[model samples]
Target chain A: MERTTFNALDPNSNVGCGRGSGVEQGAEETIFTEQASDDHVIIKDSCDVTVTTTDIQAAVNLQVAIQLAIALVLSVSIADGSQAQKIQQDLLQRISTKQLIRQKTYIENSRGIEVTMTDAEASVSIQLLLQVLLALVAKLDVL
Target chain B: MNESDQLANKLGELLLGDVLERNGFTPSSKRPLTPEQKQQIRTVLENLQVETERFLQHSQRTIRRESKPNH
Candidate 1:
């Protein structure tokens, strides 16, 4: 709160004693509307800053979520279907069958010259090593 | 693990961690594969098996037959 003094009219008015005729005029006016507008700008800028930060965080979160979704889809998409399951099951059965054959042949070899060359056979493994690379580029689009 | 490995592990957890936990995977359990994960893993293994077999068959056919080696 602002303080006011009636001492200008009283004998105790030491500071205002030497003042001119304009000194006794009423109190100065303040434009509350202008001050309110300034306060509004400050509030608006603060809100904008907060909103910008929130938007950036939201965008980052969305990007991470989208990337995760795509990866999840890619990882599981090819393996989701029954057709894929069937292919794998058939292949596993074949591997089991080969393993049995290999085991039986190994046992038989103990008695005589091996009838089957199970040990000589190359293993069925991921062939990452390249003996030769044959590249063919085919236009995949119908156009 | 490197950054990519860490990222992959994080993504794996995001996708399957809860599901695996629900399927009775404990930290101490060996190969605690959930039904869905097991199927996916098997599908991949089977694909690899089939591919290896096909390649082996092709190689076998292309290879020259050697005379019976002496024991």
Candidate 2:
């Protein structure tokens, strides 16, 4: 009878290539090192201001539109007695609510970003709103 | 906060103050203004006040012109 014995040092042995081994260690080291260097610090001196004139312009325009609509409604209601009081009250409440909303939005927007305004544009919008308000008030007075 | 920031803050407070005053905002209101917040309000109010004056003047002119008799 001939006896065959298993040798651990065989080149083709599967025992040495078991589940967890040093080969994976090299790969893990490389991966860990790569990951460690991936996160880079970015230093910034000044942040970019993102708020545009367009935003303010659009908001002002919308306000003007609302004012015009209110004026129109006031004009129609004031022509009739009972409706005048109701319209005036409704308009006042609506304006107060809108002003509150505007204040909130303005603060929120201004908090993070820098807003640049030109004197000309600001003056224009102010003029527009004042005119609309005056017109509406005049109509209300007549009523 | 640098000097520029401080100045800006002051301007903002002034504007906010104007707005609050114009809108009948009281310190006892639900939305109380902090010192910093007041500065912001003041800035907005200042800007708005300028615009409001301009608008009122323009409107007055328009009304006057409209009320004029046709030659």
For all the predictions, what are the DockQ values? 0.02, 0.03
Off by over 4 Å in 1: A1-143, B1-31, B60-71
For model 2, residues B1-71, the per-residue Cα lDDT tens digits are 55643554454344434433454433333222246644543454345446544443342210000111112
Q: How big is the positional error of residue B22 in model 1, measured in Å on the Cα after superposition?
A: 30
TM-score of 1: 0.18
- The estimated TM-scores of all candidates read 0.18, 0.22
TM-score of 2: 0.22
Task: Judge the docking of candidate 2 as incorrect, acceptable, medium or high.
Answer: incorrect
Residue by residue across A77-139, what tens digits does model 1's lDDT show? Answer: 333344324332432232221221122111110101112122122221112111000000000
Model 2 regions lying over 4 Å from their true place: A1-54, A98-143, B1-71
Q: Which candidate is the best by DockQ?
A: 2
